[model samples]
Every structure is written in C-alpha cells, then in structure tokens.
Target: MRSNHSCTVSSAPYANITCIIHDDCILPCSFRPTGTVVIHWYKQQIPVHSYYYNKDQFGLQNKHFSGRTCLFNSHIPHGNASLLLRRVKVQDRGRYKCYTSTRKGNQEIFINLEVKALIQSVNMEMTDETVTCSSHNIYPIPQVTWATDPPTAQGALENQTTIKTTDHKGLFTVESTLKILDNLSNHTYFCSFISADKTQVWTASWKNQEDITQEEGHALSISCIAPRGLQNFSLTWTFTSSSEPTVISRYDSRTRHTFNLWEGQAEPNQDLLLLGDGSLLLHKPDSEEHSGTYTCTFSGLQSRHIVQTKVNITVASISVDERSVQRSWWSTAASAAFVLLTVIVALPQCVRQRAVETSTASHRCNGAGQRWTDGLSAV
Candidate 1:
C-alpha cells in the first residue's frame, strides 16, 4: 500500500459578499496549485469557525453564529473554499476574511458583507379603494411579513404579500396589498422582512388615504406628485354630476403638476385666478348643484396620482333684526305709492273727469253758483 502524503494549502480570498432574507449567500474564494487544504472563516478579524477535508468543525465559533454559517465546499483538493451564510442580519454587516493553509504557503482573501434594509413604495388605485406597496431591488430572497400597529384581537386583516424573482437580474422583489376600511383615514401600516441570518429590515409606515377640504362656493384645486422630475404626463378630471366638470386650468413643471376647477366652463376668463398656481375659484356656488365628488387623475411614466375631494356648500343664513324690519317696511310703502301714481297716470280720461266734477261742484256751492242758479231760472 502506497502511503498518501497530505499537503495542506491556504484558502483563497472571499469577495462580492451579499445577503438576502431566508436565502443563502455565497462568499466566493479560490486558490491555485490544487492540493489538500484547510479553510477557515473569520468575522471582524476573529476566528469563528473552520471546515476542510469533508469534515465539519468549528475552530472558535461564536455561540450566536453556530448552526448558521457553513462552507460552500469543504474539500480543498480542487482549491475551492467558499463560505455560505444563511439568513443574513444587520449585525452580520461587516468585514469577513477567508484564510487557507497548505504545505505551499498561507493564502487569504477579504470580503465586506453589506446588509440593506427593505425599502417600500406605496400607490393607490383610481378608485382609492385599494393601495399597493412594493419592495424592489432586493438581493437573496427573504421571508417577507406584514403587520398593523394596533394588534387586532379579532384578528382583523388588512395586508397581503407576494414575492417574485427575476432570473435575468438574479434579484427578488416583494409586493404587498392592503385593503383600507371605511374609517381608515390616513391609517398607517408597516412591512418587514427577515433574512436567514436573523436580520430584520423594516420599511416606513404607509398611509392609504389623504384628507381634503374645500369651502362652499369656492372652486377646488388639486395637484399630483411624480417621481423624479416631471416629463410627459396625462391629466383628467371627472365629476359625479351630469354636467362635465370643466378643467378650469392646469400647469406642469419639471418638478410637479397641478389642476384647478372653476365655476363656469373652462373659458379664458375662468382660467387660473392666479398665474402658475393650481388653485381654482368658484364664481357663485350653489352647494346643492356643485357639491359632490371630484377626482383629479395624473399619469406619468413612473407613477400615477389620483386625488379626490368632497365639496360641501356652507350655506350662510341672515337673521331678521330691527334694522332689517324697518328697511323692509320702507321698501313696501315706497312700492305702494309708486303703484298708485302709475295707475293715475295710465287712466288719463278718468282722472280728468273726477277733477272736473270736483271743480264744478265747488263753483256751484260758492257765489258763482248763485249766478248760475239765477241764469238757470231765467232760462
């Protein structure tokens, strides 16, 4: 039997470190001059574990890292010694160095592990009934989870999640859906994901709705925000009434866009009461006629925004006081005198006859009446 001489070689340096939730990450390392070698994994300049020759062992493994770290391949005959980290965490975000030892010499490679927390983007549908939150550009698939701040004793559910992996980019994305209740005005919810390394990444709380208020007899103006700078966009406004709600005015800038509503049709005079602003002005508002649901829609290359506002007509009432009563009485008396004068002027023949009768009666009763009586006796 030929005695086998075991030659030991050092492991290659590790590079391109990455971590994802629940998914396995490979820290790549390689060496030349293939031979029997031992590979060791170190975190932050401390020897935590070792593996080689098809045997699994720990050199100075940290209790917290036990059963969580492994080598891609322990057998070093072919000069391949890579570390596999499962379920990465924020604490695991640090420098990692791989060392290999062989009869030829000692070889080592340094790698930096960077862990990124999950990022969330929220959007709403045209109807504003459904809101979708999506997390993109995440590496190493992770276990995604969601919860509401206020725990539901009845287990009231408001969130759902889905995961998708792209073979081309070798990246994973998570999408979540939240159903808003009627009373959920500006209610906030959070989405979180945990990596296999027991690291937690959380996103900012998201609100599914916005609040808007407009005074009675005043036009309502609304605006939408777009990611990045404003480019080409489409806008539309819809009202609940039979009459089409005129788009009183609109403006688009490199940053944002706005739309306004006016009382009458969108004519020249009905344009923006102020230039370059999205505010609208109502001419004469009848709450019952103009108050209802109004929606502003904006669509761009990257995102879409829909804003809805309810117009409530605030009707003001005037009370009848002493001053008003006196004013009204004077107005009525003036109107009655004007009517009598008009009637007398319109009946010219009747007015003249009444005057003549009165004058003749007075003449007969006076001294001239005695002369007329004597003349009548003579006749």
Candidate 2:
C-alpha cells in the first residue's frame, strides 16, 4: 500500500553533537509527516533501536544500546524522530544512522556523536618545600605540567613526580608533585591539567608566602577572603612552624560553621569571626605558637585558591628592650651636657677674681719702690 514518492527527510544542519559522558544526549533526525512511521537506528551496520507498528521494537536491538535508547514517541506524529540516548559513554562516540520509512518512501540521515568528560577543578597545595597539583573525575586521561613564575630551568623540575589513575567509571584522577629545591620565596608555581584531545585545560597557581608582619600580643586578622557569590565552599587555615603543617581553623559554607583546631593555643568560639569579605579573624595570637607560615585554602565547586602568608611576630620583650636602650642613651647624653655647662660657668668667675688680685699687688710694689728712693736721697 506504499507509494513510490520519496519522503522529505532532512538531516540536522549540525551533524556533530557533543555530549558529556554519563549524561543524556539527543541525536536529531526528522522527516515530513505523511503516513505511519517506522524508524530504525544503527551505528555502522549494527542495529541500535527500532520502532514500528506504532510501538517500540527491541527484539533485534543492539546489546550496547539496550535500555539506553528511546525516541520522542509523543512528538513522532509531528515529524520529530530525535532519539534520546541515556548515560552516554566514551564508546558511544561515532556516526549514527537514523533510517525512517513511511507509506510515502524511506530515507536515512547520519549524525556524529562526540562524548567527553571535562576536567572539573585543578587544586594546588604546598607543604614545606614540596608542591602538589591534583584533579579528579575526568575522562580522556589528562596530562600535567608544572612551571614557575620566574621560569625555572628544566633541570630544576627533573625531580617532579606524576601519577594517573582511573575510577570505577573509567574517569581519570591525576596528581603531580614537585620539590621546590629552589628558593621557595617570591616565586609562583603553576600547574595545568590538559585533556588528551587538548580541548579542555584547567590551570591552578600558588605563590610562596612573603612576610606579613604582626607585632606580638596583637589581635591579628589573617585574610583568607573567598570569592563572592560562591556556594558550597570550604576554607581552611593552617600554620607551619617547623617541618610539619598544622590545621588551625576550618570553615565550611555548606555547614555555616567554623571549627577551631588550635585547642589550648587558640581561643575557641571567641577567637573566630566570619567577616564580610570571608576573612578569618584571630584574637591575640601568641608569638611562640602563631609565629610561622599561615596558609589559607578556599575550595569551591568551580574554583580553588591557595594563599600562603608568612606572619613574623616581633617579640614584645625585644621591642621593650630596644626602647629601654634608647631611653638610657638619651638620659646619659643630657646629664653629660649639664655637667659641662657647670664647669664652663665656674671657669669664667675664677679668672675675673685672679685678675683683680694681680692688679692690686702691682700698685703696692710701685709705692714701695718710691719710698726707698726718697730715703736714699735724704741720707
């Protein structure tokens, strides 16, 4: 009962469809609505899905596509034959053939599906002289690269170690670590995760701490400001004095709570305040305990930041000693000047008295000489 007239079957203008792995995707194909529709989907020559007799037919469907393929049945009457593919896999990337037949004629169209799982987040952390970069839940295994702000020599990165692993779903997890034998100050380290196809790349950077001076016994506010409008974020504040780094405080935006890990060294609830800018506030930091490196890491779903701040606590006793030394020097100089002024004033008065005495003695000697001369003349 079918006519020889060719049906108006049109292919998607965009033959390429990129879908995220583990997500649903649609392969588009349509034709003019004329008569009862019969559709069969194929990859190369392999049967993927079928529909006929006004219902879905799966007796001859491909094992790879079982329970994972469906057509827009409700919209089929409107000439929409788009196939919905569920839980896309990397192996599902290929040219798909959508063959449709009706009372008018039969036509087919080809659509290419590309599946990819992109790199989510690149996180970096530094502990002492070692820096680490990591990422997880990625498809098409990624490569890791390291660089420095000042452009370190190739030999400096010779000790870098990299590792890659796959999870149950065949997604990739990558990590790279490098020991910064070079000076850890004033240099910024960069890490990148690049997809195998080179289409997706995520980069994370960290700068070694420069000094932030805080005087002893002062209430200090170590800034670890998170990004604005960020949700489901976690903030961690850590301190490092010797070889080991210790967690001092933690805040999770999801829980809307802050945890102080410093125990006896740090005040509990009274020491922490969530500032408007998301900075951490600490009260009366102890010079001996808190005088070290403070690292604040803010991690969110889409972004990550690692900030290292060096807090050099100037000892209160040392400052007091310096002031005492300055005051002693000033007092000694003032007393010496007063004694010299007294000596100078007495010298002038003594000189005037001695001169008056010498003038009187000279007049008496002249009178005696005249009396002797008159006595000699009378004799």
Measured with C-alpha atoms, the lDDT of residue 201 in candidate 2 is 67
Candidate 2 lDDT over residue span 166-236, tens digit each: 88777788889999875654577778788888987676767765677777787776665444455676777
- Shift in Å, residue 379, candidate 1: 69
Per-residue error (Å), model 1, residue 140: 18
Query: Each prediction's Cα lDDT score?
Result: 0.57, 0.79
lDDT of 2: 0.79
User: How displaced is residue 365 in candidate 1, in Å?
Assistant: 56
Cα displacement (angstroms), candidate 1, residue 349, comes to 46
Q: Residue 37 CA error for candidate 2 (Å)? A: 1.6
TM-score (all chains, Cα) for each model: 0.37, 0.63
lDDT per residue as tens, model 1, 1-379: 8535334544444465666544667777666544667678788767656876657687578876777887655345677777777766556767888777665667778888876544333343322554555656555555655545454433445345464655444445766665655555444444555544554454334333354444555544443323234356555555555575655445454334545454263212223312322233445556576666565544444444455556565664445786698889989999998998988787897788999999988877797878888999999
Candidate that would win on TM-score: 2
Q: Which window of 10 residues has the lowest lDDT sum in candidate 2?
A: 267-276
Residue 378, candidate 1: Cα error in Å is 70
lDDT of 2 at 154: 79
